[model samples]
Every structure is written in structure tokens, then in C-alpha cells.
Target: MSVEAKNLTFSYEKETVLRDLSIRVPEGEITVFIGANGCGKSTLLRTMARLIQPEKGAVLLSGKSISELKTKEIAKQLSILPQGPTAPEGLTVEQLVKQGRYPHQSWLKQWSPEDETMVENAMEAAAVTSFRNTPVDDLSGGQRQRAWIAMTLAQGADTLLLDEPTTYLDMAHQIDVLDLLHELNEQEGSTIVMVLHDINLACRYADHLVAMQGKSVFAQGRPEDIVTNDMVKQVFHMNCHIAADPIFDTPMVIPYGKGRKPYGAIAAAEAE
Candidate 1:
């Protein structure tokens, strides 16, 4: 396993977020965490990334405790893209990407050809090479997100953990960002773990899906195997039809409330 939490517990002061949760993120696959707001999907991800220490148990990276690893060692092994990442004002895309190489820098070598190569390759892989000179804050939401992804890519970590990568993006831009991540997972074999609110999109993208409920995993496995009507109702507390996505053959949720029912199946108020 690239990363796994062993009976981890965490709390935001008094209220517990993760309570004795344990799950292994499969290597070189896309694993998505799904849950309603404040259910601790993001909090679990934070523990996996070592951003917040667990109150009990441990997070193990490659079978070793993450807390025991050096900061640079951890940085070189895993990269994180937190939600709503921001760049300094007037920071060009290239400059931002270059920052990813900081962990590799030491008193011996300030910069190297390998660093430059990684930056270039990362920009190319993320398709943000054209925007290398553009200010990160000046680009569209999708482009800016890609630029930030490039920086994380430049870190050369085989593992990636992201929090709500598609937040604030339009449908098209959301697909664009997700497609980029999918490609990275498919082509580079990167171990990816993410927290996503859109269950349909998560089903489409995830190789392994973990559903959170009451601050613990409700179910986890292949989306097709674990995503059922009952799972949705319990995890999200909403009645939904579990339909296959026409394009991807993944589970698509048709929520049964507050929408126009053109077939006159049921009244909107009745669906509630």
C-alpha cells in the first residue's frame, strides 16, 4: 500500500471528525472519498496527507509512520493540492511550478537540470505549457487549476491527494479537470486519492470509491459493487435512483426531489 490509515481518530476540538477509521488507498489507482458536508471525507484526506495529525493510531506511508518521516522525504513521496489553492499576486505559472522543486534543494545544489526537466514535463503533461508566462490569478478557473496541478506534478511524487479539485468550476471545466486527472492516473500510474462532492462524477472517475457516513466509512470498493440506492440514501440522506451512466457505465444518481418530472411520474412535492 502506498498509504493507509490504521484506526485513526481526529477531532476538531470537541467534535470528533474521524473516529477509528481505517482504509488503505490502493496503489496506482484513483480512489475517491464521498460524503455529505462535515462527514469527514476531507478530514480523512487531511490525515492521509499528514496535514493534520490523527488523535490516535497512525497514517502509514509505504508501511511506515508518516509522522516519523522528514518533511522533505514526505514531500518527495506525496504531493497535495488543497481546496481553493491560491498563488501570490503576479506569480507566473512557471514561477509557481518551480516552487515544487523546493524539497529537493539542499546546501549542495541550488538548482539542477533535472529540476528544469521535471518542470517542463509537468507543464506539458498538464497542458499548461502555453500559459507558462501567464499569471496564475489571471487565468480562467480551469486553466488556473491545471497550472496548480502542474506544480504538484513537478514535485515528482508518485502519490497525489486532492481536496475538491472541481469546486467552483462549471460543468465543462469540471470535466476538463477530471479528464486531466484521469489521464494522469491512466498514463503515469499515479496513486491518487481525492474528496469529491459529486457522487456521479466520483463514480465515473474512481477506481475505488469510499463512502463516508457518521465520520467513518459506510462502504468502500468498486463503484459498481458498492454504490446502491440504499448506500446513497444512508450516506447522503437522499432518495435517488441508481442508474448506469450512458457514457461511462458508472452509477449515476437521479435524485428524486424538487425537479421537473416531464413524464408525469410523480409530483415534485410528493418526491420530497
Candidate 2:
């Protein structure tokens, strides 16, 4: 299913964070939101997921306004993993994953063998079966993240929205989570949208990139088409040289900062 925001205008009390913004997330693709802090990336994601209503416009899920759908009806189509989700104390991984099946359950229709199979398959797909009986709090950072992802997978949603899925993870763990998301998009044709702080990694994994600046989208398109030096400068307030990655060939941003430059660059500057 596809999600589209139409002329959304939102605010945090008196201050407007997203103003007359619109975006249509391409189905079965990975769309990443990139911007500086407080640029409404997360806010936009929440609005699309129907977690919060926009003040002016509506969020459409597959051409229908989400305001008309029931909460469980929405949950069956989309799953959102908010930033830094916390499990209940002492909740086992399997138990936490079972919670995702709530939308599929009702007074007349109870849990079935299919739900059991789905829960198990989700645990296995997330590679968290080894710790199925373990408490969520006992797992490592990456493992905990995987366990939560398993819950979302169990929800049987075609679209997944993750807000900063890599937050607080080390370099290796960050890539680990993103790689899992990428695999889901490629293998299962799941539509994925996420807010990412790392622009280079965002470019590598995103089929579409939305660059936000001051409550508006600076640009939106394929990474190679829209990610430019001027976009980085205006959106992130940083001067960067955009080049293709050696491995993925996506746009690689090399920011000019306080790091020591190579001797060749220094000598070239002296020649000028």
C-alpha cells in the first residue's frame, strides 16, 4: 500500500514544525528522510502513520483518508516502530512478538494456528529465535532492535515506518539494522520509510530520498538525482563534496570539517 501526505500543516503548540508539506511514498520501496535536527522528519512519519493528525490536511493510505479507518484497520496495513521503543519489564521476546497479533484477534475470532505460525516465522526471520525465551532487556542493543522488528513483522503489515532505527547503536550495529530493513524491502517487497541522521548511509539504502529544510522538502527523488553539494549546504548547513560510493555507488558525502586533510590537498592549496 502507498502512503501520501497532502498539504499537511502541523505544529507543536504555537510553533509550526511542518508547514504545507506533501509527499507520496512509493510502494514497495525504501524512502529515507534526511535533515538537520527538528526539521519535522519524525513528525511527518508520525502523521503518515496516523499517530498524529495534521492541523490542515489529511494523510491518505492507498488513496483513502486514514481518518476514516479504524485504528485496528490501519494497524493491519501499516506498522510503526518509533525511536527507542521500550518493552514491558521482563517481557520475553516471543511474548512481545505475540502482541503484534492483536489486530488480527477479536471477540468472535480468537487466536488460531496461523497466528502461531506467523509469530514463529517472524522470530525466525528477524533471527531472534535463539533468544525467544530471553527477556527483551537482557539482549544486546542490536538483538533488542531485532526483537522489536520481529514484532512489527508479526503485525503482517505491508508498510513499515521506523523513526531513527539506528539511534544509539554503534557503527556495526547501525549497519546491521539497516541491512535487515534493506533485505525486507528487496526480498518481501515491503514498503519502508525511515528517518535517518546519517546522510551517506541513507543514500546507500534509500530507493527515494526526501531532503527536508525548515518544515519543507528541499528536494525529493532518487538519491543520485537529488543529493547535491548545494542541497547538503542548504539543508544541513554543511559544505560537502558529493561523490559515488566505492561499493554501492550511491552518493557519498564528504563533509569539510575540522579533520586533518591529506598532505596532497594541503600542498594543492599552497600552489593556488
Candidate 3:
């Protein structure tokens, strides 16, 4: 299923966060949103996920307005993991993951063998099976993140929306979480959309990239096609060189520091 925004406008109290932004998330692909802080990437993601209602436009899921869908129907097709999600103080990982089965259950069909199987598979996929009995508060940051992802997986939704899934994680943990999501997309053919602060990692993992600037999408395409030094300067307001990543061969951003001049600036100075 695909999610499309139609001239979405959103605000918080008196401040407008997103303005007339429209974008389509391709089905069965990983799409990453990248931009400077407060650039509306997260707001746009939230609006797409139906966590926030748009002030002016609508979000369509699989060609149907999400606002018109039943809540349980929407949950069966899409799952969202918001930034910094917290659980009850004493909730175990297993307990938390099982909660994802709520959408699949009704008064007449409370629990089924399929639910048990899904919960186990999700835990195994996220590599949190061993911590099933552990209190979520006891796990390290990365482990907790994985456990939360397992919960989302247990929802059995084809589309996953994550906002800054790597926040508060160390470098290795960041890659670990992102790699897990990549594997999920490759193996399950799921549509994964996420907001990422690390541009390099976004380029490395994203099959499609959306760069937001000034409350709208500045560019949208494959990272190799859309990410450039000029694009970086435009979105981030910084001087940078775009290079091919040695590992992933994707676009890598190398920023210029306050005391350093970009190679272009240096060359221009020498030409004077």
C-alpha cells in the first residue's frame, strides 16, 4: 500500500510546521526523510501516519482517505513508532510486544495461535527474543529500541513509519537499528518510511530520499540523483562536498568547518 499527502498543512497552536507539502511514499520500498532540525520532516511523517490531522489537506492510504478508515482497519495496515517511545515502568518486553495484537483481536476472537506465532517471529527478527522476560527499562538503549521495533513488527502491518528511530543511540547502535530495518524491508518487502537526522546513513539505507526545507519537500529521488553539494547547501545552509561512500557507494557529505574553506572557495581564491 502507498501513502500520499495532498497539499498537507499542519500547525501547532499558532505556529505552522508544515505548509502545503505533498509527497508519495512508494510501496514496498524504504524511503527516508532528511533535513535540518525543525524543517518539518517529523511533522510531515506524523501527518502521514495520521497521528496529527492536517489543517488543510488530506493523507491518502492506498488511494483512500485515511480519515475515512476505521481505526482498527488503519492499524491493520500501518504501524508507527514515534520518537522516544516509553513503556510502563515494569512492562516486560513480551508484554509490550503482545500489545500489538490488539488490532487483530476482537471480543469474539481474543487470542489465536497466529498471534503467538507473530509475536515470537517479531521478537526473533528484532533479535530481542532473549530479552522477552526482561523489563524494558532494564535493557540498554539499543536493546530497548529493538524491542520497540519488535512490538511494531508484531503489529503485522505492511507499512512501518518511524520517527528518528536512532535517536539517543551510539554510532554502532544507530547502524544496528538501521541495518535491522533494512533487513526487514529486504526480507519482508515491507514499505518503510523513517525520519533520519544522519544524512549519510539515510543515503546509505534509503531506496528513495525526501529532503525537506522550509516546511516543504525540496527534493525527492534516489539519493545518488538528488543529493549534491548544492542540494546540501540549499537544505542545510552549509558548504559541503558530496563524495561516494567507500562502503555503500552512496552519497557521502563532507562538511566545511568555520575555519576551513570549501575546495571551490579555495580554488576561486587562488584564481583571484
Candidate 4:
């Protein structure tokens, strides 16, 4: 599925969060949005999800305007996993995953084997199958996050949007979740778009990278094409050395201090 935003603008009360923003997420690929805080990343994401309407432009799903599609119909075409999800007290993992089937069901078409199989597959894919009977509130942060992702997966949508999906996860769990997301994109050909805080991680995982600065797209391309030191300095206002990662050969950043070097190197050299 393809998501295209054309001249989108969003405002809350009197403040504008996104202004004249336009982006086209590659179809059937993982695209990561990276930007400084309050740079309108989440706002743009919500607008694309149809959670918030744009005042100026439209977000198109496939070829149709998302607003023109019925809410349930849109849910079937795309699903979003917000930054944080709250489950009702005592809700089981199975119950939470089953909720994803709501858009696919009606009074006349209650539960079916298809729904059961989808839920089971989602749980297994997220590695949350063992926690199916466990209450959502009882799971750890990572496990709970996985359960939420599983629910989104069960929606069976062609496109998935996630906001800060790695938040609250330790380093290991962060990679774990990202790896799972990559696997989903590879295997199911789902269009995955997300906002990520870690630029290096985004480069490592994203098939396409979109960098935003001051409510506009600073750059968009493959990681190697967009993640240069100049882009980092322009967007983040920090000096950094960009190098190729030994592992993935992606761009890696090494930050420098303000007019200083490690261990007072200048002072030590003067003494010598």
C-alpha cells in the first residue's frame, strides 16, 4: 500500500504543528521519520493515520483520500500502533489481540476460524504467544509492547504506522522489536512508517529515511544518501563525525564536544 501526503497542514487551537508538509512513503517498505523534538513528526503521522484531519491537504491511501473511506474500511487498509497503548485492567493478551478483529467483524459475521488463525499468527510473530493467557498489565514493558504490536498485526492491514515504537525498551529489546518489524516488512510486504528518535538505529533498520527540520522535510532517501554529517548538523545543531559502521556498513555518528577533546588532549600535549 502507498501513503501520499500532499501539502498537508495541521493546527491545534492557534498553534501550527505541521505546515505545508508533503511526503510519499514508499510502497511495501519500511520508512523511518527522524527529527528533533517538537518537529511535527508525530503530528504528521497522526494526520496520515486519519486520527487528526489536516486543514489544508489530504492523505491518500492507495488512490483514495483517507477521509473519504469509512472508518472501518480505513482500518482494514491500514493500522497504527501509537507510542503508548493502555489496556483495561485484567485484559489478557489474547483478548487484546482479538480486539484487532473488530473492524473485520459484524453482528452477522461474528468470530470465525479466520479471525482465530490471524490472532494466533500475530501472537506467534510477535513472540507473545506464551503470554496469551497472561493479563496485559502483568507483562513487562517489552512484552506489553509486543502484545500491542501483535494486535496491530492482527488487523491484517497492508500498511502499518508506528510512533516511537522503541520507547521504554532497553537496548536489547529495542533491537528485538525493530528486528521483528523488519521481518514483518520483508515477509508480508507491509508498508511500515514510523517516527524514531535514534538516528543510527533508524539508519540501520529503515529502507527509506525521512528527516524533518522546522516543519519541513530536510531530506529523504536511502540511509546512506540522507544521513550525512551535514544533515545531522543542520537538523540537530550538533557537530558529529559520520563513519561507516563495521557491522552493516551504514552511516554511524560520533559526536564531538564544544571546542574540546577527550581527556583534555590539548592540555596534555602542551605539557609534553
Computed on alpha carbons, the lDDT of every model, listed in order, comes to: 0.92, 0.93, 0.93, 0.90
Score every model by TM-score. Answer: 0.95, 0.95, 0.95, 0.94
Candidate 2 residue spans exceeding 4 A from truth: 258-272
* lDDT for each residue of candidate 1 in 230-272, tens digit (9 for 90 to 100): 9998998887677789999999988874353423443443466
- For the record, the alpha-carbon RMSD of candidate 1 to the native fold, in angstroms, is 2.8
lDDT of 3 by residue, 96-211 (tens): 99998999999899899999999999999999999899999999999999999999999999999999999999999999999999999999999999999999999999999999
**Cand. 3 TM to true fold:** 0.95
lDDT of candidate 4 over 1-272, digit per residue (tens): 67899999888888888889989999989999998898899999999999999999999988789989999999998899998889999999999999999999998999999999999999999999998999999998889889999999999999999999999899998998899999999988889999999999998999999999988789999999888768998888776777788999998877674575434553464346
Ranking by lDDT: 2, 3, 1, 4
Candidate 1 — worst ten consecutive residues by lDDT sum? Answer: 260-269
Candidate 2 RMSD to the real structure = 2.2
Q: Show model 4 residue runs off by greater than 4 Å.
A: 257-272
What clash count goes with each model? 0, 0, 0, 0
Which parts of model 3 are misplaced by more than 4 Å? 263-272
lDDT of 2 at 113: 95
Clashing pairs in 3: none
- Better model by TM-score: candidate 3 vs candidate 4: 3
